[model samples]
Target: MAEIVLDKVTKRYADGALAVSDVNIEIADGEFVILVGPSGCGKSTTLNMIAGLEDITGGELRIGGVRMNEKAPKDRDIAMVFQSYALYPHMTVRENMAFPLRLAKVDNATVTRKVEEAAAILDLKAHLDRKPANLSGGQRQRVAMGRAIVRSPKAFLMDEPLSNLDAKLRGQMRTSVSRLQKQLGTTTVYVTHDQTEAMTLGDRVVVLRGGLVQQIGAPQFLYDHPANLFVAGFIGAPAMNFLPATLENGSLSTPLGTVALTDRVRRAAEAADAPREVIMGVRPEHFEDASLVDAAALDRGASFDAQVEVLESMGAEKFAYFSVEGGEAHASDLADLAADAGSAGVPDTGSQVVTRLSAASAVAEGQPAKFWFDTDKVQLFDPASGANLTYSAD
Candidate 1:
């Protein structure tokens, strides 16, 4: 219902340890923004500062166009749902949901109406009389959400609200939360360490690292056009692949093969005014079966060939892992790759090159395989600075 803004927002502890720095973001009315990063990345700290639970050591926070630095949490007109599902165990669902309204001395009739409406919205009508002790973990989390929803606050701030649920339940709740946000049209700011949650739930995701924001955009935007190495590695299911390469005459020389640069990337590099010491990046899904690729469609130069090592079938598609002829030295820093695979557990086969092929494609492990990518699909970054070679034309 209201826009939120953070202007050069920063947070620091009494010990002088910085928690967040210079994070400036503008959340439009009714937009669901997610703050995401790894553990100890200051996401929760930033959320807490916005909720008025933590002091801002520098910068400013504004909600609905008013400076909120001196405002009490009660006056901020924001409702927060935390990870722990902070419900009063002694009270029934109805009582728990009605507590906030009661504190504001709302009349009993209005409280009953509001609680009934919230319970119905959350599908908790049948469990209103049940105590928290008797409810399942998912139900308890719904109760936490019901409490926040009943108030109809200016915005909803959620801090990993689904962390306590099982995987299946978490997936179900992800859809439920997203649907609820849209149905209510509430402005929301959600914080999580889970990349999938950030990718799926947010209108715009703010990727942060070490107290600084890496990038802010739609989920696919960050995945397709990362601003730096950290954003490149953090925003995808199977993160973008990075290979050391040297740039000469506008082409990147990789062990696998050379990838020709597009005019956009070339222009960006030229604008940066630096010699081309760069890293070449490609998404796992960007590679195609080399034989099937149309060379005529390419801009004079774009292609790579490698040998496959392992194959993984995910029902509708296959991921082929292999090694480029001389790519053994690049194997040491695959932590980013392993992390992106999540629970599948990336195998330790030596010197592997990986690409996701379509379900209809005929490629097998250990086969001599070739892959092709559009030149524009490739991303280039400064090896030393980790900054994207291509800044936006805007």
Candidate 2:
């Protein structure tokens, strides 16, 4: 295992279009790191640069404390698993897994031992004699992984290896891949466009956009305290609701009504020198049915009535959707977020909010319902700069 470091790395095309900016990331030995972003967001380009598949326009690339800016892919001692599987139909599972060892001119007995070990680790011991054509999608992916494992390279690079499988199969394979990586304890760098995979698979996630590093930290840290409007909107599942609000005298006035800022929030806003006009963000899970909250809890939050446009019963919980009277929040940063999330063409005349309520609550569709949101959980952002005003290094 080896540590990888990218110091002020940059990639620029002949047309002078920058694909990756001066991004710096230090991946520890045996750590699993994921590169995640929307389409054309330079994730794949960054991975390819590390794999020596693309040239670095500027800055240094180091692995195991050795400068590798000009080294060839074969000399980097890294194995890559692509999305296509790229297995040979004519070769059996054992033969495919042992091909790398044979290419290095290892003795026959050593090759058989290595292939058998990898097959056992991947739960493919029974299918060693079968060809790639006879295996399922998940099985084929494992075969590709086994081929990489037998090489015993210094690191593993996987690029959306499970995208071709069905949803259920992908989930199953996710568990398998995670277990295998932990057992082997190899340094890994995975690239994917799926936020779910990025959240569940890596020790740390790197969120990128427009060839720049947006945020880098644990998944829950980014979810709870995003650094900017784009990171806040991109990390959540249903996405956080953004509403235009006016801040005055430590209070926020919005369509939902006026909310008195908590002591913590007030201090943060004052420290950051927040503007008078700001954007307020609240997650879906943060809202609750007012009828279900305790009296003491109700005293700490603000409540409002809205007509429920749609309700979805998810067995464990319910999702209530409502539309507020005010028009959609207008800002260039919001527009960029919408475009990156594939919602640029969606027309919205008013703000829409989703609330996750307990299954015991009785919220009906097309009826007025009372929803309460905790004031302390709210996040405030500056409209002009898109910076989270309440953010702290801690």
Candidate 3:
């Protein structure tokens, strides 16, 4: 219903510790934007600042083209759905949805109409008489959503609203939330630590790190062309694989073997004055079982043999893990990513390269299998700054 803007917004605690620093983002009217990163990356703090739940130490916040820096949470005219359902145990679904209107002293007839409309939109019409205790997890979350929607606020701030649901239920709720947001067309800013949710649920994604803005773009753009080592590792499932390599004569020598740089990559790296020591990045999807590759297509790529340490059959595809000599690529940026993954309980598994192979491929664990990787899809990153040397703005 309205646009929101954070102009150089910053937050600093009394102890001189900064939670968010100089963040600038604009949410167009009815646009759904996501703020995503690892825990303590300041996404939730940024959302809290916007919802007026936290105070800004500097810069400005504007909603619907008006300053909101000094306004209270209720006065900001926004609705927030938190990780917790936070429903009143004593209230029925209908009463919970209508509570905001009741507090505003809206007439009974209008409140009833609005509550009914919200229930219908959320597919909760059948459960309106039920209490939170009687509902399933997903249903209770929908009830929470219904409560927020009845207010018809100018914007919605959601902080990991699907965090508590089971995996299947979370997936279903994601679809439901996407549909509901479009149907209502309210400006939305969602905060999440899940990269899957960040990729699937929003028009644009704003990636943050250590309270700093990393990159802002469409999900696919960030996936295909990350700005730095951290963004490259953070945006994808299984993350992008990094290999240490030396660049000379437009060719790279890596653990995977010698790779002739593609023209696009060569030019970009050359223009950036790339160092001889660089990090080569390749996405999981870019690699495939060599036997499955066409002979004609084989001319455009290269192949190497490695023993598969583990093989996971996923029906549609197979996830094959391999150990390469020289271990995982080492850099400060990469170390930070590893630390985050460890803290989040993601398996370290030592130095493994995860590749998505065709489901029909007969590769098995502990067997030497040839794998082919597309040369043109390779990306080069600066080892020191963690900046993508082969990044293209176009």
Expressed as tens digits, the lDDT of each residue in 160-255 for candidate 1 is 999999999999999999999999999999999899999999999998888988899999888877888778878886667777677888777776
lDDT (Cα, tens digit) per residue for candidate 3, span 1-394: 7999999999999999999999999999999999999889999999999999999999999999999999999899899898998999999999999988998899999999999999888899999999999999999999989988999999999999999999999999999999999999999999999999999999999999999999999998999989999999999998999988899998889889998888888999999999999998999999999999999878788899999999999999999999888655668788888888884345554467899998999999999999999999999999899999999988
Q: Against the true structure, candidate 2 has what lDDT?
A: 0.90
Regions of candidate 3 where Cα sits further than 4 Å from its true position: 343-350
**Once superposed on the true structure, which residue ranges of model 1 sit more than 4 Å away at CA?**
298-301, 325-352
Cα error of candidate 1 at position 288, Å = 0.7
- Point out the worst 10-residue segment of candidate 1 by lDDT: 328-337
C-alpha lDDT of residue 150 in model 3: 94
Q: Rate the local accuracy (lDDT) of all candidates.
A: 0.83, 0.90, 0.92
* Poorest stretch of ten by lDDT in candidate 2: 325-334
**Rank by lDDT, descending?**
3, 2, 1
Shift of residue 384 alpha carbon in model 3, Å: 1.3
RMSD to truth, every model = 3.1, 1.4, 1.8
TM-score of each candidate? 0.91, 0.97, 0.96
